[model samples]
Target: MKEVLVGSACAIALALLAGCSAEQPAGPAPATRPLDPTAADLVARAGSYYADEQVLQDAEATLVHRCMTTRGFRRPPPAPAAPVSHDEEWRPDPAHRRTDGYGLARAGRGEPPDPYFVALAPAHQERYQRELVGDMARRATLDLPSGPQLSYPTTGCLAESRAQLYGDVMEATRVTSVTQDLHNTVYLAAQADPEYRRTLARWADCMKRRGHPYGSPQQARNALAAERRSAAPTAAQRHEVAVAVADAECAAEVALPGTFESLLRRHAELLPEAQRAELNRLATSRAAALRHARQVAQR
Candidate 1:
């Protein structure tokens, strides 16, 4: 468990697939069938351990602002709330498909530059970074479950803010990575299971009937992702909506969401004892951090 000391001094912060060529009509929203009581209970239990990222980011920015202002730097504007996550499901949720589709174009457009920071001289900017984040030469690192290592400043205002909110900053970070790992593990497992493969085949058949010819939802999303970069933004978004509508309809036709949830529940039950203990401990830490974050954000 390496403590991640690396963070942005300014404040450490924090996908659709597929292209349809023509803009198809987005009719009534597809129905996402309600999960059974057992599945719903599991989802609720798992969800409780996680804090809202946007709220947490808001809290962090607030803490960083207060810390920097006390130290005499002009305050940076509040960072925008984190965008909705695409990986919330294997496919886009109903609202996401209807609204943003893949929403790739919208990325990198919303973050406002820090005017106060921008006005500083080059020498001053370097000093600001050091003061805001801590020593750039020294780093703290955490290895993600997905094989990538994340590094950040551990000694700056960002670190102090994180420590204030989360008792053990590294453990707090680990909670997120661990849960992400769990989701990836379970999702891949779901894809491997016979029942899920059958559902996917049915979904593929549905997509074929609709003229998408995609083998999996991910494949469609991938194709769209590639196409979006070349096409006009408006055209790409419209195509996304059209494809997303078809994707949702096909997913409903096979009850893919429910099937995935069922597999997730089953996989969670089978996790190793050590991993489960880790989750329980991390969840407790996250719950406490979330409480403090809410208080900070409110102030």
Candidate 2:
């Protein structure tokens, strides 16, 4: 699959895992930390600016199909309709862990091949690739603050799809990307906070009690990765599910999500006013884009 313009909430879960761990062993902190109103408002504001990644994926698929078929190519199979959630601000929860189990099974179920593309002649395949994503030699780039530079094509079905939804593909890409960078920034700041560390230690202890000996969620995930390599496929899957379930349970026991949210709020206040304004402007554009995307998706 071609990479999307923005990241999903789950994409940030890796950083969340690291932020939720501790260096020093300690008991869980008090579970009653008062929520910060300012931070809550900031998150609420940020969430308003974005849709779930699945929604964008499905919509773009619709647009891409239209663009391709107009150029006389065979229409690809329609993308399945995604369950839409406009203001989804993802936080780690045990239910997701129980169901996805670190997403190994989902990862294993690789993307299906496109029959139309597969049957194409080599020359036609080259045309298809160019039509889908444009020239690889010439690309547009965006240099994000405190993040790596991002580049993509300025033409083709991919570009057309993005333009249809975001109005200005390059600018929208830069604008929407800020939320992810902000999330990364907050997570890094949270890692150094003593309160967050203490809560993580409690979570570690909780996991240890449940028969998973791990100092951090990242460590447990690493161990699972190695286990997948060494153990039988079935056995590895079973082990992964067991450890993931225990990890979620321990996270709950230690009030990990609540603590992390508190830390997010505390650290989020440090963001510059200019960045916040950018987010607000992006939200306006996103809302307008989603309206168009919804209509296209329905067709």
Q: TM-scores for all candidates?
A: 0.74, 0.75
lDDT, candidate 1, 40-77, per-residue tens = 23233334322366667778889888887777787655
Residues forming the 10-long window of minimal summed lDDT in candidate 1: 11-20
User: At residue 2, what lDDT does model 2 achieve?
Assistant: 95
Winning candidate number (lDDT):
1
- Model 2, span 239-288: residue lDDT tens: 88788888877777788777776777677666666665555565556667
Q: Clash pairs of candidate 2? A: none
lDDT assessment of candidate 1: 0.70
Candidates in order have lDDT scores of 0.70, 0.70
Candidate 1 Cα errors over 4 Å, as ranges: 1-51, 76-83, 86-91, 107-116, 143-149, 229-233
